[model samples]
Each structure stands twice: as C-alpha cells, then as structure tokens.
Target chain A: MKIKKVVELLNAKVVSGHDHLEAEVEFCFASDLMSDVLTVETENLLLLTGLANLQTIRTSEMSDISKIIFVRKKNATEEMIRLAAENEMILIECDYSMFKTSGILFSAGLKPVY
Target chain B: MMHFEFHVEGGNFLKAGAASSQLKKILKQLNVDPKTIKRVVVAMYEAEVNIVAHAYKGDIYIDIDTKKIEITLIDEGPGIPDIDLAMKQGFSTASSVVREMGFGAGMGLPNIKNNSDELTITSEVNKGTTVKFATYLNQ
Candidate 1:
C-alpha cells in the first residue's frame, strides 16, 4: 500500500519525510523493542513502534526501514525527528495503540515481515 | 586497508549507535554490498548498544579491507560472568532505564553472533569485556 493511504487509514500525522508519502510499502513490523526491530530484514518495510526515541530512529536506519508509525499517540522528540529526517525515513504519529495500528494496516493489505 | 577508532560513553543512550552509524556510512561510500553492509551495521550496532547499556566506557576499533571487516569493542565496566547465559536470547542485565528504551531484552549478543561470520567474547567480572567479530565482504 502507498504510505499516503496508510496515513489516511490510521489517521496518522507525518512527522518527517513528507517526500516519501507516495512510496509503496509491502511489509510492516510492529514492535516497541528496538532490538527486535534490528533483526528484521525486509525491503520496502514499515515500522510501527511505540518507542519514540533516538534509538528508534537509529534502529530504523540500521535496518534500512524507511517508514515508521509511532503508535499509542507517542510523539517523536525533536532529536528523533531530526535523525529520521537525516536518514530519509518517513515518521508517522498516530493516536492508536500498536495493536490497533497493526490491525488496520494489515487489514489494508500491509504484509507482515514474518 | 583502513582503520578507525571511536569512543563510546557508557550509559549515554543518545550516542549509543554513533560508531555503528559512522561505519555504515563509510561502508556505503566504499561501495560495499548492501547485504554485507547491513550485516556489519546490525552486528556493530547491537554490540555498540551493549556498551552503552552496560559499560562505564568503551572503545570500538574497526579495520576494513577488500575481503572483510573486523570490529573489536572493548569496554571498562562490569563484565559478563556467564558467557553462555548472556548469549541466550532474552537474557539481560541491563537496568530498567535501559529496558524502557526498548533494549535489554537480551538479544544483542545473539544478534551479533547471527550476523557475524566470526565472533569471540572475553570478560572479567567488575572489570571489563571485549567483543570481536568479523564480516566477510565477499559473502
């Protein structure tokens, strides 16, 4: 699904990387654990995480994950936004919990990384 | 051949992956294969986080060449007493603060082992630890 559609489906706010809205993503991984996030090796992936910190951005950078949705209304700090922007990652913030966000995206045709 | 050194301040969450990030950039500029670069970065980042989440101070030594990349991380802090136990997935000695930061689920070393072609660890309790790993570029 295109990230723009995901934004509309989850009512998510784009925190950074607006230029990537049109990007198509096939896989989504939801986790609060940055360690688990690093173990994933999928392309065109989206990360739905509640952990809003610099490490989250760092994890995404290492994993080559380009899109992130901060679930449970978690707000990305200024440092995180700056880092994500530098990594060219698209950061999204949503009020829904991780589970809910994952369900919505999965229902909307986002495949899991498993 | 190229060698680089980076210092890691223990318990400094914000700067945890700086060294790994820099290495990744250098590998990219060197036109290393993407898969090889990912393995190197993931292994290095996990090891880097281990230092930040547990050690008092650490240093990362990196050597890159046409055949492979070798990394050695030495830290001055409480060393692991049980290497076998520490290698278990989900075994962690990190504080609650580190756990809250989405780490400390005990996967760092295992992840490094999974990504590296060669791995070795040595430590002395209450003193320090050393982790060395290598990733072959041609793999």
Candidate 2:
C-alpha cells in the first residue's frame, strides 16, 4: 500500500517527509517497544508506533524503516521531527488508537511483518 | 581495514545510537551489501543502546575490511553480574525512564546475537562490560 493511501485511510497528518507520500510500503509492524521494532527485518515496512521520541527515529534509521504512523494522537517532538526529516522518514500522526490504526491498515492490504 | 572510534555518554537517550547511525552511513558509502549493513547496524545499535541505558560512559570501536566488520563496545558502569541472566529474553534492568522511551524490553542482546555472525560478552560487576561482535560482508 502506498503511504498516501495510509494517510488517507487513517486520517493521519504527515509530520515529515512529505515528498515521499507516493512511496509504497508492503509490510507493517505495530509496536511501542523499540527493541521489538528493531527485531523486524523486512523491506518497505511501515512502523505503527505510539512511541514518539528521538529513539524511534534512531530505531528506524538502524532498521531501514522509512515510514512511521504515530497512533493515539501522540505528537512527535521537535527533535524527533528534525531527525525524521534528516533521515527522510515519513512520520504520520493520527488520533486513532494503535488497535484501530492496525485494523484499518491490515484490512487495507498491509501485510504484517510476522 | 578502516577503524573508527566513538564515545557514548551513559543515560543520554538522545545520543545513544549516534555511533551506529554513523557506522551505517559509512557501511553504505563503502558499498557493503545492504543485508550485511542491516545486520551490522541492528546489532551495533542495540549494543550501543545497552551502554546508554546501563553504563556510566562507553566507547565504540569499529573495524571494517573487505571480508568482515568487527565492533567492540566497552563501558564503565554497573556491569552485568550474571551474563547468563542478562542474555535471557524479556529480562531487563532498565529504569522506568528508559522503559518509557520504548526501550529496555530485554531484547537488545538477543537481537545482537541474532543479527551478528559472531558474538562475545564480558563484564565485571562494578567495573563495566564489553561486547564484541562481527558480521561477514561476503556471506
């Protein structure tokens, strides 16, 4: 699924990396645990996380994850946004809980990493 | 061989993985295989976080060559008393503050072991700990 579609479906706001909305992501992984997020080894993966911090961006940097959805109305801090922009990461914010965001995206053809 | 050294300040969440990030870029610029680079980054990042979350201060030393990349992390902090216990999944000594940042879920070492081709750990209770790992580029 394209990140653009995800933004549309979840009513998410793009916090960074607006230039890459047309990029397609084939897999999705939802986790608040950075360690668990680091365990994933998939390409074109979209991370659905509620953890809004610089470490989240660092985790994405290490794991090669370029797109993220911050659920439950979690706001990315300025530092997080700056790092995301630097890494060319598309960070999205939504009011939906992690469960609802995952359900909607899963129903919309986003394959789970597991 | 290319050798790089980086310092890590313990308990500073903001600067935890800076070294790993830098190493990832270097690996990419050197034309290392993407898969190999990912493995190196994952393991290195986790180990780097371990130092930040537990140690007083740390140092990262990286050596890369045509065949493989070797990394060593040494830290001065409250070292692991039981290496066996520390390696267990889901067992962690991270403070509440660290947990809130979505880390300290006790998967760091296991993740490192999973991603690296070879791994070793040594520690002294009050002195510190050292982690060394390698990933083969040609594998």
Candidate 3:
C-alpha cells in the first residue's frame, strides 16, 4: 500500500518526509523493542512503533525501513524528526494504539513481518 | 578495501548509531547489495548499541572489502559473567532509563548473531567485552 493511503486510513499526521507519501510499503512490523525491529528481514517495510526516540529512526535506517508510523499518540520529537528527515524516512503519527493500528493495517492487506 | 575506526561512549544514546549510519552510507556508495547492506548494518548497529548501553567506552574497528565486512567492538565496562546467559533473549541488565527507551530487551546479541555470518564474543567480569562479527557482501 502507498504511505498516503496509510495516513488517510489511520488519520495520521505526516511529521516528516512529506515527499515519500507516494512510497509503497508491503510489510509492517509493530514493536517497541528496536531489537525485534532488527530481526525483521523484509524490504519495503513500515514500522509501527510506540517508542518515539532517535533510536527508532536509527533502527529503521539500518534495517532499510523507510516508513514509520508512531502509534498511541507517541509523537516523534524534533530531534527524531530531524534524523528521519536526514535519512529520508517518512514518519507518521496516529492516535490509535499499537494493537488497533496493527489490526487496521493488517486488515487492509499489509503483511506482518513474522 | 577500506578501514574505519570509531570511539563510542557508553550511555550516550544520542550518538549510539553514528558508526552504523556512516558504515551504511559507505556500503551504499560501494554498491553493496541492499540485502547484504541491511544485514551488515543491523548486526553492526546491534553491536554498537551494546557498547553504548553496557560499557563505559568502546572502540569500533571496521574492515570492508568486496567480499565481506568485518567489525570488532571492544568496550571497557562490567563484563558479562556468563556469555550463555547474556545471549539468551529477554535477559537484560540495562538500567531503567535504557529500558524506557525501548532498548535492553536482551535481543541485541541475538540479533547480531542472526544477522552476521560469523560472531564471536568474549568478556571478563569487571574487565570488558570484545565482539567480533563479519558479514559476507555477496550473500
């Protein structure tokens, strides 16, 4: 699915990488632990995480994940956003909890990284 | 072939992934495959994070070539008493602050092992730990 569709489906706010709204992502991994994020070995993946920190962006960059949607209203700080922008990663914020966000995205045909 | 070195200060979460980021950029410039680059970056990032989260300070030495990338991280800190226990997932000695950042899940070493082609870890209690990992570029 295109990231723009995800933003609309979740009523998410694009906090960074507005240019990447058209990017396509096939898989989603929801985890607060950066370690779990690293374990996922998929391409074109979107990370749905409740952890809003610099490490989140760093982990995504290392794992080749270009899109991240912060769940449960966990807003990415300015530093985090700056890093995402530097990495050309898209960051989205949603008010839904991680579980709900996962369910919504999964039902919409996004595969899990299991 | 290229060589890079970096010094990492423990507990400095802000600069934790700097080395990994730089390495990824270099790998991309060298035209490494995306999958191989991801594997190398993930393994190196996990090792780097271990140093920042557990050690007092550390040094990272990286050697990159067309065939493979090798990284060695040596840190001075309270080393692991049992390497086996530390390698187990969900076992962590990270502080509460580190846990709050969504780290210290005890998955760092395992993630490194899973991503790297070869991994070695040695430590002495109260002394330090040295982790050596390598990932093949063609795989």
Candidate 4:
C-alpha cells in the first residue's frame, strides 16, 4: 500500500514526512516493544507503534522499515521526527488504537512480512 | 573469520543503538542480502540493548563472514544468577526507569534467540555476561 492511503485510512497526521508519502509499503507489525520489531523481519514494512522514542526510529532503521504509523494519537518527539526524516522514513500519527489501526491497514491490504 | 569491533556509549539512550545500526549500514554497503542483514541487525540490536539496559559497562564486537555473522557482547554488569530463568521471554529485572525507556520488558534474550541461528550466553556472578550470536547466510 502507498503511504498516502495509509495516512487517510487512519486519519493520520503527517508528523514530519509528507514529501515521501508516495513511498510503497509492503508489510506491517504492531508492537510497543522495540525488541519484537528488532527480532522480526519487517523490511519495507509499515510499523504500527505507540511508543514514541528515538529507539523506535533506530528499530525501524535496523529492520529497513521506512513507514512508521504512530497509533493511539501518540506523536514522536521533534528529535525523533527529525531523526526519522533524516533516515527517509515516512512517519505518521494516527488517533486509532493499535488494534484498530492494524485492522484498518490490514483491511486496506497491508500484511505482515512473515 | 575477520573481525570488526564497535563501541556503544553507556547510559546514553540516544546513542544506545549505534552498534547494530552501524552493523546494518556496513552489511548493506557490502552487498549482503537484505534478509541476512535483517537477521544480523536483529541479533545485534537485542544485545546492544542488553548492554545498555544491564551491564552499565561493556562493548559490542562483531565478526562477519560469508557463511554467517557472529556477534559477541561483553558487559561488566553484575552477572545473571540463573541463566535459565533469564532466558524466559517475560523475565526482567530492569528498573522502572529502563522500562519507561520502552525496554527491560523481558523480551531481549528470547528475541535474540528468535533472530539468530544460534545463541550462547555465559555469565558468572559478580563478573559479567558474554552473549555470542550467529546468523547464518542463506542467500
């Protein structure tokens, strides 16, 4: 799924990335633990996370995940957003809970990489 | 196998993940397959977190080769009392502060085990912990 559709599906606000919203995402994984995301293969995936920490961006970078949709209305700090943007990751903030955001993205045709 | 070592700053959350992040970057530059890089990074990242979250003093050493990538993490923190108990997925002794950092959730070892082809952890009471992980290449 293209990132633009994902933003609209969840009524997300683009926190730092909009120019690259046209990026294509191939998979999704929702987890608050950076450990889960690190252990799992989430390449080209759109990560659904509520935890807004610099480590979140680092986790996504480790797995080559470029699209991070922060659910539960959580937003990344300015430094986190800048770091993600510097890495060319498309960061989004959504009001929907993690479960609902996952459902919406799934129904919109985004699946897990595994 | 040829060896490359990387250092991680202690108690710095902003710099906590640098070891694994650099490993991923170097692997990519070497043209290693994406999946292999993913596995290596996963294993390394978990170890890196462990170092920051626990040891309070340590370093990460990475050895990369054709068949596999080997990562060795050595930390001087008080060693684990029971390696078996520590291996459990939800087992953690992390302070509340570490938890707020979104780590210390007890998934570090299991996640490393899940991502690596093989994992070996050795620790001595009051000494430290040494974790060795291997991620085999398939492509």
Candidate 5:
C-alpha cells in the first residue's frame, strides 16, 4: 500500500514529510517495543505504535522506516516530530487504538514484516 | 581493520544510544553491506543501553575487519544475578526512567544475540560484566 493510502484509511494527521505520501510500503510492523522494530523491521515498512518518544523516532531512523503511524491517540513529542522531519520520515497521528488500527490496515492488505 | 571506542556513562539516559549511533555512521562510511551494518548497530545499541541502564559505566571497543567485526563491552555495575533469566525477552532490571525512554522491555540482549553471529557474556557479582559480539562479513 502507498503511505498516502494509510493516511487516508486511518484519517490520520500527517506530522511530517507530506511530500512522500506516495511512498510504497511492502509491510507494516505494529509494535510498542523498539527491540522488535530494530530486529525484525525493514525499510519502507510502516511502524504503528502508541509509544511516543524520541526513541520511537530514533528506532525509525536506525531501521530506515519512512512511515510512522502513532496509534491510540498518543502524540509524538515536538522533538520526536522534529527528528522525524530531519530524518525525512512521514509521521502520522491517529486516534485509533493500536489493535483497531492494525486490524484496519491489515484488513486493507497490510502485513507484519516479521 | 578499523578500531573504535565508546564510553558508556552510568545513569545517563540521554546518552545511552550514542555508541550505537556512532557505530552506524562508521559502518555507513565504510560502505559495509546494509545487512551487516544493521547487525552491528543493533547489537552494539543493546550493549550501550545495558550499560547506562544497569551498570556503573562501560566502554565498548570495536575491531572491524574484512573477515569479521568484533565488539567488546566492559562495564562495572551490579552484575546479573541470573544470566539465564536475564537473557529472556521479558526480563528487565531497568528503572522506570529507562522505561519512559522507550526501552527496558527486556529484549536488549536477545536482540543483540539475534543480530550477531556469535556472542559471549561474563559477569561477576559485585564486580562487573563483559559482552563480546561478532558478525561475519559477507563474502
């Protein structure tokens, strides 16, 4: 799925990298654990999580994850958003719970990178 | 061979990941294969976090070779009382502050082991700990 498709499907607010909406996503990894993200993830995979911190952004950076969907209405910190922008990643904020978002996106053809 | 060193300061949450971040940069500059680089970064990052989260202090020494990459993490801290249990995914001794920083999920060592080709750990109670990790260079 294209990243923009996820944005539209979730009705999420794009926090950064509005220009990369057309980027392709081969997989989506839903996790609140940075270890799992660092170990199992691949580039271009969308990360869905409720944990909002600079480490979330840092984890995305290390894994070259270009798209992040913040679930459960959790907001990313200002530093997190700024880092995401610097890292050229698309950050999204959504009100959907992680389980629901995963279901919605999974039903929309998103699969875990694991 | 390329050599690198990183200091792990105890109780410094903000600098916990500095070592792994720098190692990633170094690997990128050397044009190491992305797969190999990720192995090194993830493993080393786990070491860095362990130091800050559990130990008094640590120093990571790296030896990058064409055949293999080696990393050694030495720390003076409260040693692991049970190595077997600590290696489990859900085991953690991290404080709340570390958890608030998005880590301490108790997956660091397992992640390190999963990413590296070889790993060895040694610790002494009331003394310190050392972890050695190695990954083969792709032929």
Candidate 6:
C-alpha cells in the first residue's frame, strides 16, 4: 500500500517526509517495544507504534523501514522529526488507537509482518 | 577488510544507534545484500542499545571482510548475574526509565542472536559485559 493511502485511511497527519508519501510499504508491524521492532526483518515495512522517541526512528532506520505511523495521537518530538527527515523516513500521526489503526489498515489489505 | 570503532555512553538513548546507522550506510555503500544488511543492523543495533540502557560506557568495534562482519561490544556496567537467565525473552533488569522508553523487554540478546550468524556473551557481575556477534556478508 502507498503511504498516502495509509494516511488517508487513518486520518493521519504527515509528521515528516512529505515528499515520500508515494513510497510503497509491503507490511506493517505494530509494537510499543523497541526490542520487538528490532526482531522484525521485513523490507519496505511500515512501523505502527505508540513509542514516540528517538529510538523509534533509529529502530526504523536500522530495520530498513521507511515509514512509521504513530497511533494514539502521540506527538513526535523535534529531535524525532529531525532524525526522520534526515533519514528520509515518512512519519505519520493518527488520533486512533493502535487497534483501530491496525484494523483499518489490515482491512485495507495491509499484511502483518509475522 | 574494514574496521570501524565507536564509543557509547551509557544512558545516552539519543545517541544509542549511531554506530549501527553508520555501519548500515557503509554496508550499503559496499553493496552488501539487503537481507544481510538488515540482519547485521538489527543485531548490532540491539547490542548498541543494551550498552546505552544497561552499561556505564562501552565501545563498539566492527571488522568487516568480504565474507562477514564481526562486531564486539564491551561495556563497563553492573554485569549480568546469570547469562542463561538473561537470555530468556521477557526477562529484563532495566531501570523503570529504560522500560518507559519501550525497551528492556529482555528481547535484546535474543534479537541479536536471531539476526546474527554467531553470538557470544561474557559478563562479570559488578565489573562489565562483552558481546561479540557476526553476520555473514555472502549469506
């Protein structure tokens, strides 16, 4: 799915990487634990997490995940935004709960990174 | 062969993944396979975070050759009391602050082991800990 579609479906705000909305993400992994995120090995994955910290961005960068959707309306700090921008990672924010966000995306045919 | 070294300050969450990030970029420049790069980065990043969240200070040394990349992380900290116990998933000794950051789920070592081709860990209770792991470049 295109990141733009995710943003539209979840009513998410583009927190960073506005130019990369057309980027395609093949899978989604939702976790608040950074360690679990590290365990995922999917390519072109979209990370859905409530953990709004520098490590989130770092984890995404390390895992080659180009896009992140922050559920629960969590705000990304300036440092987080700066790092995502520097890494050319797309960041999205949504007011919906993690469950709702996942449901919406899954129903839209976004597969989970299992 | 290429060697890179970095220093890590414990509790410096902000700078935790610097070494791994740089290594990822270098691996990309070297045209390492995407799957290999992902494995290497995941394992190394976990090791790096272990230092930031647990140790007092640490150093990361990477030796990359045509076939593989080996990483050694040594840190001064209150080392693990039981390596076996620490290896179990969901077992963590991280401070509440560390846990609050969504880490310390006790999956760091396992994640490293899962991603790396080989992994070795040694620690002395009150002294320090050292983790050495490697990922194949041609895998």
**Global Cα lDDT for candidate 6:** 0.90
DockQ of 5: 0.54
lDDT of 3: 0.91
Report clash pairs, candidate 3: none
Interface RMSD in Å per candidate, to 1 decimal? Answer: 0.6, 0.6, 0.8, 1.4, 1.7, 0.8
**TM values, all candidates:** 0.98, 0.98, 0.96, 0.89, 0.91, 0.96
Q: Which candidate wins on DockQ?
A: 2
CA lDDT of each prediction against the hidden true structure: 0.93, 0.93, 0.91, 0.83, 0.85, 0.90
Going through the candidates in order, their DockQ values are: 0.88, 0.94, 0.85, 0.70, 0.54, 0.88
Name every residue pair that clashes in candidate 1: none
How many angstroms is residue B85 displaced in model 5 relative to the true structure, after the best TM-score fit? Answer: 2.9
Q: Report the lDDT of model 5 for residue B88.
A: 94
Better of 2 and 6 by DockQ: 2
Chain A TM-score values, per prediction = 0.97, 0.98, 0.97, 0.94, 0.94, 0.97
Summarize candidate 5's per-residue lDDT along B84-139 as a digit string, tens digits: 89899899988988887778888999988888899999999989999999999985
lDDT of 3 at B4: 96
Stretch of 10 with least lDDT, candidate 1 chain A: A37-46
lDDT of 6 by residue, B105-135 (tens): 9999988889988899999988999999988
Q: lDDT of candidate 4 vs native? A: 0.83
lDDT of 1 at B116: 97
Runs off by more than 4 Å, candidate 1: none
Clashing pairs in 5: none
Interface DockQ of candidate 2: 0.94
Better of 1 and 6 by TM-score: 1
